[model samples]
Target: MSVFLAIVLLSLNVGRSGGAIKPVVTFTPNWGNILYLDDVTLTCDVPSTAPEEPRTYHWYKDKRPIPGDQQTLHIIESLGRDSGDYQCQTIGGDISDPVFLNVTERYVLLQRLPSLIYEGDPLTLRCHHHRFCKAINPKFYKDDQEIKPSGSDSTFHIPNITRSQSGRYKCTKQIQPCYTPNVQELSDESFISVKELFSPPEIKVPPSRVIEGDEMTVRCDTRLDPLRGGTKLHFAFYKDGWTVRGYDVSDTYRVPSSQLEDSGKYTCEVRTRSDTVRKRSDGLYIQIYELFSSPQIKVPPSRVIEGGEMMVRCDTRRDPLRGGTELHFAFYRDGRTVRGYDVSDTYRVPSSQLEDSGKYTCAVRMTSDTVRKMSDGIYIQIYELFSPLKIKVTPSRVIERDEMTVRCDTRLDPLRGGTELHFAFYRDGRTVRGYDVSDTYRVPSSQLENSGNYTCEVRTRSDTVRKRSDGLYIQIYELFSPPEIKVTPSRVIKGGEMTVRCDTRLDPLRGGTVLHFAFYRDGRTVRGYDVSDTYRVPSSQPEDSGNYTCEVRMRSDSVRKMSDELYIQIHELFSPPEIKVTPSRVIEGDEMTVRCDTRLDPLRGGTELHFAFCRDGRTVRGYNVSDTYRVPSSQLEDSGNYTCEVRTASDTVRKMSDGLYIQIHDYKMQNIIRLGISGFVLSAAVCFIYFHNKW
Candidate 1:
């Protein structure tokens, strides 16, 4: 068959060449396989618009001009020898692209894809058999080598294709359910080409600092080769591996309002007309800032007294991701400036005063931003100072040994309640007690030493305006020893005047001092409150017999001194009392009584008198108002000297008793002699009677 088709092609080409200039030629049914004995036609084209212009065709096989007939149709019969690449030229010098023709008696076919491809692209090939049946497990090869697909598919697909994959490629497939595994059909040869028309997309942002509610624009740009002109491009934006915006034909994108979620790793992708050819850019950091909270003013100690230290601070809440933002602070007092533009938040006052009081506020914001916030107002009030004090003494009339209170009173403003005050006490233009914060000073025990003109000094914080009170006189008295009562004779007869004097031990240290005198008897005042030292009774009487004491004091007496007591006695006349006994010569068997009486004292007028009767200088009878002595029977023992005494109550003025003597005789001895004479006469008669009875 090959020998016969060669002979037929040689006869057709004989004497067909040698045309003028050049023209274009083509075969009808421009693409696809032509089966054996298929009717085909060719046309010779010329660029000249005139129909009368003469034209001719020139044909070539495998890039060599062939001598063919000048007719426009080149026909192929039974196709074995006519299978080749053919090009043609017109007589007017126009050339045409060569087209390939292949004819085979085998029932297998191979399909080819586009020859020109971008670097990042995919390639596909299809193989078919004239039997019109499916084939499984197809294999493809480049330059007679096999192309192994990554997965199980009959058709071959090369993914992410590059320029290195360019070569002649062919594919083969076995008939499905065939008994022999080695039986395969071959496909027609085809060439592949690769061109670098893309670089990685570069992403950029005009403004690096993007906050919430801010508009942002993103650009993904790529370089292109002029040789790949008219290539279509698509763009995509990605965040953290997820697509922020799907691929679109536009290169740059706009975001109206960026949010906190928009902050992350961002990238862009650029693509050619083919979807598989694309470049992704490196990640760009896009951060969205959050707004900062309003500033607040803080005071360390809310309450403070005058002259105390305090601290004020300004603060705010912010997002930590604001990498380069700095916070600045300013303080205001009642709309006036206190501190301006201070980076530090704290302001301090070492000592607060009344003039330093007002409403306070603080303003804070970021240095990079124009917005700032001012805090609410806080108040600081300074109290008026405690000053111009006065002194007061308790118990206006203070006596010796009396406890006293000295108070230093200062004017206080209730608005400033925390004022602290210090005070001191003075006496006789000298400090009596040290300075103390307490306003009251107490004298535990007041003595003569405490007697002086007293004053006080009140102060707050050293009493810048010192004040003193008027002097107060405090008088006291000293205690003296007891007074003495002296009498002229010390003893006085009844009915006579006696001199009595109240004498005190006058202190030599206080010589010639004016003193007051008072006299007391038995704890009762007798002569009271007199300047005279002597307290004399006009006449001394028995009633003057009592205990006497004297008291002495200064003219300005707050307290007095009492004297030891002395007893006084006024007596009667020295004559003895007379005594009398009834029946002075009474016999021994008779009853007797005795009586004695003393002379009554004229000074003791109407005073009840007491008397006693004495025998042999001893009291033997009554000492009562009844001044009589009596015996029931006069016996020999009752015959003795008898006397009586006279005295008043307390036995102060008593008189001695007078003595008397009495005699007595025995009456029974005389009656016994007469009885003996009568008994002798009776004895003579008894002797005569006894002699007569015995005979």
Candidate 2:
């Protein structure tokens, strides 16, 4: 028995003269530490204070009895789950306290992070083997070749990784002789891939906001760059968590008529030809709206009287394509907002009064959209039950260049209706034609200034009670006059400034109203056109040379007219610049310079020029305001073809210079001969020393 077990027996015997001996666990070779791929042995021991034969002993791991016979347990190879607290028990003696034993690994393993590490990104490789002891003098290898000398490091790092770094990598861990172990060395290997393209596919839809009955196109916007590798990509389109189409090479999927069911979460999946890589985009939700036309409201009986009932009806000429037949209605009295809200299509006034004598309007709204159509207001007047003092306008819907007439109804009703009434017309609370005993107001041709709310007041020549009619709102459009773009100096240059003005003339005889101006270049509105009449460019570039025009919108009538496109030509000094080297090629001890020529002799008189030189896509000389790049000392390293760039003061219209090849030849014949003679003398002296030693 072990000394620890004997001690436990003595303690139990001393405490109680007739007590049972305690049970304990023991390990073989006097060891308990376990390692991966290592074998270990265990035994259970029990003792009795009495001098009789002892009972049987059993072994338990983690306080649970395992299936086995005898008093010993041997583990051939320790695994991760073998680590636990062990105990032993006898028939009568108390079971032993838990004895903790941990199993660890010693084999080397290669690992990498679970994140994407693309080319040009920092990369790291780790060797996991130093669990029980330190790995001394570790070495890293690539493609079975040593990359560095043996050092005490387990991690290899590359600052800026490139595609060339893709290869099989491995690491070696050396166990120095001083360590007490059978293992001498360990190695781990893994393959690494440096990706160059890792971007996912993007999705788009034509007609961003879709409506029912519209032709729709759902596109997966991914195109291969011709300059890159030739890798075929397969596309898949998905909607509402299910594949709509798959295994296709095209990037777009078309639908003849997009409906409400076509709108849902949409996503696109892009995969490589070999299916080795895949990427999916996030879902995009779409909603399709219905289409509807403007609605109109009808008034019955054509007239209203005080203390009489009347009905107003709102209706849409055609129903919308959107679902559901239910609709909502809203009415406005004077300008707008007669009441909060109403859902009935028919608005009935139980009793007409003078307060309800103003203009009335109605509109119909679909439940799915906030868009609704507003009907032109209809005037309804409330008069005495039998009064005949009435006024109205002929040709109520009058456009520009049209005539309108305002006439008071002179025919009196058969029952006490007023007659012989003087006429007074008021526009927006101001009298236009006073009570001058006239019954008609006529306009030969209406103008934009004639748009206003008009009302008429009439009274019999015998009665003093003046009756007023409901107001009528009219809109008079203005005639459109296209504006023209006027460029100062008529001609523009790339490096020079120019001013652009929008000029138009309205009817000068009757026009003092301000006009809003806007400018356009190639049909797109230019900035600062909303608040300014003229646009100016301090320095123009080649991109600013396009078709330009101006637009004039009438502020009062909201009438817009566009001018003809003007092809603006901006002169360029460097159409196709040329680069030249005077001698082209030279030997050592020759002076050289690269000249940049614009080939525009006529425009070079007052032009401010700048020059630059480049080699191997890198700048050799930059931002030099000169036309010539003189090389101080021409050498063989400067023999590659050089490119030059010539720019003007504007710096936006620069031209590239043709490549100039400069070859430099060596002229060191004498120096070569001197080196040969020196080498021969040194060889002969070494031979003479060897022969002297032999003698």
User: For residues 1-695, could you state the per-residue lDDT of candidate 1 as single tens digits?
Assistant: 12212222222221223443334344554323454564456555443432565556677877888776464665756376767777777664545555566656554555543123557655556554544344655677789887664234645766678877778877666554244455444455567666776777888886877765457788997876553444578999988899989889888778876666778888999876557676789999888776455667787666644456767888776665654557788899889988887778877877666667888899876574354668899887755455445667776655544577878777765655565666788889889887888888788756667888878875566444345667777664344445778987666666556777887655455467778998877778878888898887765677777788888887877446777888888776433567777776776777776666566546445666677877788778657887677777777777777778876665645676556777655668646766877787789789879988998
Count of residue pairs whose backbone atoms collide, per candidate: 12, 0
**Candidate 2 residue-wise lDDT at 604:** 52
Tell me the spans in candidate 1 whose CA falls farther than 4 Å from its real position.
Answer: 1-109, 112-124, 132-138, 142-145, 149-153, 157-169, 173-185, 189-199, 208-280, 285-363, 366-695
lDDT of 1: 0.67
Model 2 stretches astray by more than 4 angstroms: 1-480, 528-531, 600-604, 617-625, 649-658, 666-695
Judged by lDDT, which candidate is best? Answer: 2
lDDT of 2 by residue, 1-695 (tens): 53333323333322222365555566553334445655667676654433667357677888888866567778777787888888876666567756666566655655453233444445667665645565666778899998866876667878667777889988887653335755478877768887664456787988887765567788887654332234556789999889988958787878766666788888999876556556787888877655444556677767665545767777664334444455677877887666434667877887666677778788766564344557778777765543544557767666555687877654544443534557788778898788857777787877767788888887656443356777777666555455788897576777668788887765544376567788878988775346366888887777888889887776653466678898788776556677787666666667778777665536456666777888766688896777787877777777777788877666755778778677776769647987999999999999999999999
CA lDDT, every model vs. true structure: 0.67, 0.68
- Models 1 onward score TM values of 0.33, 0.29
